[model samples]
Target: MKRKTIIVLVAAVAVALTLVAFYANSGIQSPKQEEKFRIAKVVRRDLGASVQATGIVKAMVGAEVKVGARTPGKVVNLPINVGDRVEQGQVIATIEQDDLIARVRLQEAILAEVKAEHSRLAKDFERDKQLHETKSISVQRYDLTEALHEIARARVLKAQAELDVAKAQLSYATVVAPIKGTVASVNTVQGETVTTGLTAPTFIKIIDLDRLEVLAYVDENDVGNVKVGQEASFTVAAHPSTDFKGRITSIYPSATIQDNVVYYLTSVSVDNREGKLMPDMTANVSIFLDRRKGVLTVPNQTVQREGSKKYVYVLHNETSEKRYVSTGWKDSSYTEILDGLKDGETVTIGDPGRK
Candidate 1:
């Protein structure tokens, strides 16, 4: 009976030790309290921070031309069409010059007739002046001839000036390109009479293709971050595959506030020499301000606050170790490890089995 009791006790002790070893190996301390930590791997990507904004592409040198005749006339001819390339002095359209020519001729004829009359009157007036002094002519007759001569001379001068102006108006009737650019559009066709009454008619629009600008409307909250000379990259929907890169050229000081929201117009410089980017193309812009390269970094999730100090867990030889670290500029993913860390260090983070 004694031997049997001792055997039973030893068997019971062995069973208890086996249960304890299994429990320790399974990593189940308690069932009530379970926790999990998200983990991330430190990566190397060009960190870019930007205030995103929707913008439109605009031509650097764009002009709408009001090239109709300064004086109203019928459209005689339009040599250029939409999309036609024109030189600076090349004629694009012609207006009816017949009326101007007729008026100029009439004025010139009138000037000639008045000048002939003035010459004869001047000779007679000079004789009249001499005769009046010599008592050969009456004072009233001499004064009257002298006044007629002066009035005829003034009329001749006025007619000559009118003739010159009429000829000049005829020259202005031929509309010409003021800039070297592609004609965006032609408003009126040949034989279409555009009324030049009061306001001048816009005949064509010319846009220079070498240079371009990106007009971005930045929200009031992000406007403070926008500054001149910030590097930026953008892509337009028209050419979605191509990236248009530029620098912030300007920030409008005045804010456009409406409906309790405010925004400012920001302009950036772009190159469109390839002519792929047209005016009014929508742009997706990203402004890059700061970056870090090849520096010691940790997953931002590992950063925990212990009282007032920042801490990160380090794994060394099957033991969990925590170290205090200093951090610097951080993005949404990684925090810059400024101090208290080095490259290639293993950090313990995340759940081993929880969830």
Candidate 2:
């Protein structure tokens, strides 16, 4: 009886262990039976092909202005600094015009006194002339009075001309902006002596940020295709990864060679109304001149090659539908489908192994 009981116990244990193993194995999923992955089929309606080149962003109208005194003087005030916006004819700085104004006042006073003296002398000379002619006054007296009158008249004219000069000098004390732009640099500050009589010493640089352009260099091979008015797009290092649209407004007739490669200079118009872009920014330009439009497309990862045959698995009825496909134009993120794909069909981009 004991031996029979042991045999029964062993049999029951073995049966229970087998049942647990069967349930665990049933829960496991097979590779071929895994759930299908979903992907998008974005239709490429119109896509442009471009030739890319590295270039720089430049302002269309940039200027370096020297807010200096036409007459040498101490700078009383410099209202603007680097990165300040200014308008045309705005007074940017001021010089001490006190000396010039004082000189003008002195000249004016001297001019008034000289005119009076000349008038009195003129009367005296006329009277002397009449007296000399009648033998009442000597010729020497009349000649001396005439000489004094002429000197007074000449002095009056000289003082008036000097007054005009002083007025002109006074006007030069105020430094004004010549263009409407943002102040790019400030070389000198308040109380600094900046002389402008000899040469244009730059005190500040102003650039019209609203009017911006990109200088692109196209390679010799692609230069032939690049033409004025061609559409272009680019991104600056200042605003990296953000795209900006522009057009090829100009193309140089000449070619430049560097490191044994020839390239043509091209200019593009950029709109920087937001003022986010600055001068001398390196731009990554894409001169797009050609495009292709609307057709079936698939994710680049969806299409796989097997022994020179491209195959894609699409999803339908919750199952993977395997099919051969052909591809066309592709970019960094998308691939164009030429054949073996239909609209609204969900394609698989990866193996459906995980939940």
Candidate 3:
């Protein structure tokens, strides 16, 4: 009987510990605590809609050129280096021209001898023609002399043409800058052999830095909204905070395809008077589409699209109410409210107490 009494007291102590643990877990929250929400009041403000795209800075068309050698020769002189400024008609490089000069002199001598022979043949032809008219010589002999005179005249013409060609080939030994620009690259150096055949070897590259432009590849959908003369602003990675302004100058007709998606190349004329931007630098561009003034606006996150319909949450007297809203122009951050919402009206932005 004493053992049974001891067992009953231990079972009562275990039951009391179980009841205390259950009450400790349930006492954290009370039924009177109210649910909280994040709310924002609608306001009127000016909003600008913009299309974003990435592009590379480039020199204008015809402003950049790859200078090449016109004839095969050993490079004897390279007067310019990378980043050197050159003007039109300036000799940037020269090839070994000793052989070319000798060829020119040889052709000149040949042309002179041919011209002297032609002069003598012409006088003989005149005398032979007079003798034939007076019956002083045979008709066959006069015909022979006439043929010899014509052959001499042809030789003179051929020699003159050869001389001109030789002079032209000699001129090719000197490479000149075709346009006024800065030398962006030097592909060849002194003593390098350049062989010109089907394609001339490139010697240098000159580009006009003053005429800088940006080629922005806008997506196919957003390209329709972009037009010539539209104002655009861009920032490069080197100067992220500084905004450069430009205007749309052209839109290429061809579409560039990548991964089955199409993009149109648009050209923007950038003003680089300060000379800070460099070629091949990437630019993040924003093309302004339109600006709406004094429009009722709300945070873009507040509105949610349900298929073709859009709706938002409205806070009325501490109760969350779902209401449909008609929207107009929208930007990256805010959306224009056309109807179903007024200025200074409270709207629920997000669910509270949820992370």
Candidate 4:
């Protein structure tokens, strides 16, 4: 019985040792399981040095025109509404012409009567001159006939002027488009009374959508980077995924202030042959100052600047080392590396201090 107890005690001791060895192995971590290092590789990419700005799309100068009435009358006919396409010389609106027509008829009748009287006086004056030459009439009577003819001729001319004035007034009642464009706004409706006083009443506003342009307000600090003929791209809220391309056509010489910040207005000429772009749409623009193809670049966050010197941490074989680099132009998220870094080199970031 004692021999059996000794065998059982040895088995119990072996089991305890096995449990302790298993726990010891599980509690310890290998060197590979220690703090891990995050790394990124130097990449070759096409980088664009650009200035970002927010601007509004507008119609180019002379692309928009306001159509107005020149005479005061009730709007009798408005054939076009907003968004209607119009051609040059197309009748857009017409005012009440009954009064103007009657005035024109009255002036015509006055002109006709004056012309008849002048013709009769001219004939009588010639006959009286013959009688005076033949001593058949007195000189004063001949002179009186000549004076009457002159007075009648002047009245005829005056009446003709009045008739021309009346005709011009009648023509003013009709409003025609000055250019070919789309009607953007209609300020008057049929039967609305419009007056032509100091200022002509606007009947419709037209815009040439084919000549749409983007007006980008660049910050004053960045205005110097923008120049004419530089390539740019923009995205509108209506077409967020679609990018429209243009070039800087002009830059306003004057500066505009908004909330104490100065901005320069830049005009970008966009191609709207497809007619997808519209006026007054907000455009997020990027003007490319420079573009480099297949250049080595690094994440901006990986670079640390001390004075004029810039450097990044490079990782190799489980070790982190400081590498001073020379940088070129940089965009918002990346920096262009001019030198001191090779392609495929691992850039270490977010690691503890390595001395």
- What's the TM-score of every candidate structure? 0.63, 0.57, 0.72, 0.66
lDDT of each: 0.75, 0.78, 0.86, 0.86
lDDT of 1 by residue, 1-355 (tens): 9999999999999999987787689886433222223333344445444666778888764433445556677788888887887888998888898888888889889988999999999999888988998999888998899899989989988988998898888888887888777788778887877666657767677766556798888866557767899988899877889888899999988886645567788998897778787778899887656665665667667776655467787655645567888865444556667677677666646423334
Candidate 3 lDDT tens digits, 325-348: 988766777878889998998887
Which stretches in model 1 have alpha-carbon errors above 4 Å? Answer: 1-49, 60-62, 125-142, 199-201, 257-260, 288-355
Q: Name the 10 consecutive residues with the lowest summed lDDT in model 1.
A: 30-39
Per-residue lDDT tens digits for candidate 2, residues 70-182, read 77878898888778889999988888888888898998999999999999999998999889889998788988999999999999889889989988888878878888888
lDDT (10s digit) by residue, model 4, range 1-355: 9999999999999998987787678875433433432457899988877777899999888999987778888999999988899998999999999999999999999999999999999999999989999999998999999999999999999999999999999998988888889999999889999987657667689998987899999876568778999999999999999989999999999998876678899999899888888899999998888877888988878888555467998877867788899876556667788898999988866543653
RMSD of 3: 10.4
Whole-model lDDT, candidate 1?
0.75
RMSD of 1: 12.4
Candidate 3's displacement at residue 224, Å, is: 1.8
Kindly state the number of residue pairs that clash in model 2: 1
Give me the displacement of residue 328 in model 1, in angstroms: 14
Note the residue pairs that clash in candidate 4.
none
Deviating ranges (above 4 Å) for candidate 3: 1-46, 293-355
Worst 10 residues of 4 by lDDT: 29-38
